[model samples]
Target: MGHTTGGPDSAKRRLRRELLAVRNALPADDLREAAAALARHALDLPELAGASTVAAYVSVGGEPGTLALLEALRARGVRVLLPALLPDDDLDWGAYEGEGSLARVRHGGRMALFEPSGERLGPDAVTDADVVLLPGLAVDARGMRLGRGGGSYDRVLARLARSGSRASLVVLLYDGEVVERVPEEPHDAPVHAVVTPSGVRRFS
Candidate 1:
């Protein structure tokens, strides 16, 4: 039998501890350099090259590398879509034209940058995306992601799977955060690729 009796709170605590430990273990310089290298590799990927529309997340905490990657993609004329967190477990896609194009939108206690003409769509919006960049605490060799205990990306990817969409799911992590395997549940969504500052890793 599996260890299934733990509640959400317990699971969240464990996940947080693991993430903190991983972050602390990484060297600061190595982490930053790796992030830059990964961003370069991601941009060079054939699937991402010349892609018009891409879906990405706002990096919080130690995930600052995403900001640089977003800037680069915008400079290259890729239409970037950022997640606008909404109530009732819904998400809206907002175009990130550039830094100056962002307008404040309130969600819970925080404000997110959004574009005026962005389309407010449901989970099905993943199907329309050419690529999806995911944020996670840790990722495994097989592309399993350990998020902040929220099922947001999982639910969106599930919808894409059901619709037979071809969007690539890419998870970004610090190099040390990539592990052999992570504790996963049935509902956990597997990513198509794992990217670190070192390189782009294709999971088996």
Candidate 2:
């Protein structure tokens, strides 16, 4: 099992590099504005309008910001659950109380992540959510999400399926991140919808 340098893995890695470079180059003001717009559009989704619990993640570095949406969901009385990366790359869940409730955590040499400072509800907690907000680098016209290759979210999706959870799987990205196609693998799953700064696109 040596390192792979071809096929879907290579294709996905190349695309991720290209996308991350663009995201990392964005001005702070533009990122902030995009975050605000993303919040507005995501809040309007019918799937979220009546949701009582949502599984979401905090953005870090070049990722699309989710703090505004997380706050808005909390304000609307939705119980928002955030992920804390587990040692095996599985995610444990915790509630998002507010801005002050997050703790900065660095896993190995990776970027510091903003995670919940409250009680951990275990990985299966995500199955209880009515909606699951996924973080991705890009998504294609067919709803295939291009993830960062961490496999954490892939486990989450599998867990949801095993639990028979009907949570709407959604990804947030910039409008340009929605492209014509993305490299897909057998384990990759299509999302229900994607919320960009400009609008929301539904796949199923």
Question: TM-score per candidate, in order?
Answer: 0.80, 0.97
Clash number for candidate 1: 2
Worst 10 residues of 1 by lDDT: 110-119
The sequence of per-residue lDDT tens digits that candidate 2 reaches over residues 117-170 is: 999999999999999999999999899999999999999999999999999999
RMSD (CA, Å), each prediction: 3.8, 3.1
Q: How accurate is candidate 1 locally (lDDT)?
A: 0.73
Regions of candidate 1 where Cα sits further than 4 Å from its true position: 1-13, 21-35, 103-106, 109-123
Number of the top lDDT candidate: 2
Clashing pairs for model 1 are 34-197, 35-197
